[model samples]
Target: MKQQILFSFSLFLLTFSSFYYPINTASTAPASSPKLAPAPKSPSPASSKPLVPTLPDTSDSTTPDDITKILKKAKTFAILTRLLKTTEIVDNLNSQLITAKSGGLTIFAPDDSAFSNLKPGFLNSLNENKKIELLQFHILPQFVDSNNFDSLSNPVETVAGKDPLKLPFNVESLGNSVNISTGVVNATVTGVVYQDNKLAIYRLDKVLLPLDFFPSKVHASAPVAAKAPKADDHKDKSSSAEDNEDGETTQGQKKSGAVSFITIEGTRTMLVSLGVAFVAVAMI
Candidate 1:
């Protein structure tokens, strides 16, 4: 009886050990290996460079208010304003001029008097795709006072075309002039007079056009060829010519000629003759 009791106890111990072993093993499993750490963040890409703003080519320093007020009061300017309002290009150009930070732009604004000479369909045609070009023709790349207009050189390039035109002109303060190469026309302002620092207003006899703005069927024209000598070239040529002229006459020769040309009585007849000969030689 003792042996059987001992065997039964042994069997009970074994069954309990089998059931508890699995539970203990699961509890000690190290918490699912601490789940892997998350990946580190990557750095951001670099930014692109910014673009620079370009300045508009102009020289007139008049304020937008001045332009607006003048245009509003003048009959010809009012017509142009109306035309500009209807055209996208012209409207944008006006807006640019108003908002431009750079001062000093010379604008050759046409007035109602200018439109008087246009054919019925001419204004309408300009209102079409050529509005930008028409607006550009009136703008000079530099600032020029009314007094400097007479000194302007030919072939002044305008924003109207890829190439420049030869502006044929003979401007006088009292005379009408047309720089066909530069596509500029100056007309007498007749009754209009400028006051204070304001520009002189004018009623144009005709509307200005770009050299290439017209269609071939209407009036095909070519850009003015560049002809004015470069500054360096002109300087070099002038210096060379002067050097040649100076080298031809030595100090000894000049002194001899002076002695021969002067009379003891102090008459300058020989000197005058020599001067005339020198001038004649220079002309040749």
Candidate 2:
């Protein structure tokens, strides 16, 4: 009976040992294998942002030529327009009209009839730089109507005159009429040729000659006058011969060397002068 009990116990022990320690299978993973990295997350729909606002566009708006268009319509202002063109201030005027932080522009323009009274060849006598200064004299960088005269701080300098020191201008207002003085010539506002918030144009019977250009007096002795004729005659004879000899040379040189500054109004002072004369004749 003891032998039978021992044999049964031994069989049960063997079966338990085989079940606990089974043989390794081919599909089993190794303990030392490297782990895979996680995938990157996609951007969310809520991450999109709105577009930023931009500045106002001025590309299609009114330009500086708008002033010229208005000025060209007025026949009496032909001389002023011509001078402005000569100095290349028409473009500057247009630019300042747009860019000026303070007053846009104020122009005290003289009529063709006013220029007609000047000494012959007066305009022709001036050099290029003098012509620019002359044109600059007529312009007040800030826009001022006749009503703003009393408020203006004088001696208000101009854009041209302000380089070394301000080309000073004085304004005095009485009733509806305004008088402007440049310490040399006095001009009264005869009419308002053009007026806007950005610009003001006042017609003057006389040109506003800056003290920078013209003097109040000229001093010459009688002897100098007598001697001038002989010297001038000598200069003229020599100049004529030199002109004939150097005409071609100077012409080509002037064409090549001289900086050509044409204006937006076209280079036609002679034509403008003729137009002014035509208008004046028609008025007569």
User: Which one wins on TM-score?
Assistant: 2
Residue 187, candidate 1: alpha-carbon lDDT:
46
Best by lDDT: 2
lDDT of candidate 1 at residue 81, scale 0 to 100: 69
Let me know the TM-score candidate 1 reaches against the reference structure.
0.41
Off by over 4 Å in 2: 1-64, 162-166, 215-284
Put down candidate 1 lDDT per residue, 82-191, tens digits, no spaces.
76566544455446555666544555566676777667787666545677667666555445444445555555544554454232222333233333333344443233
| TM-scores of all candidate predictions against the true structure | 0.41, 0.50
The whole-model C-alpha lDDT of candidate 2 against the native structure comes to 0.69
lDDT of 2 at 29: 57
What lDDT would each prediction earn against the true structure? 0.53, 0.69
Our model 2 lands, by Cα RMSD against the true structure, at 34.4
Let me know the TM-score candidate 2 reaches against the reference structure: 0.50
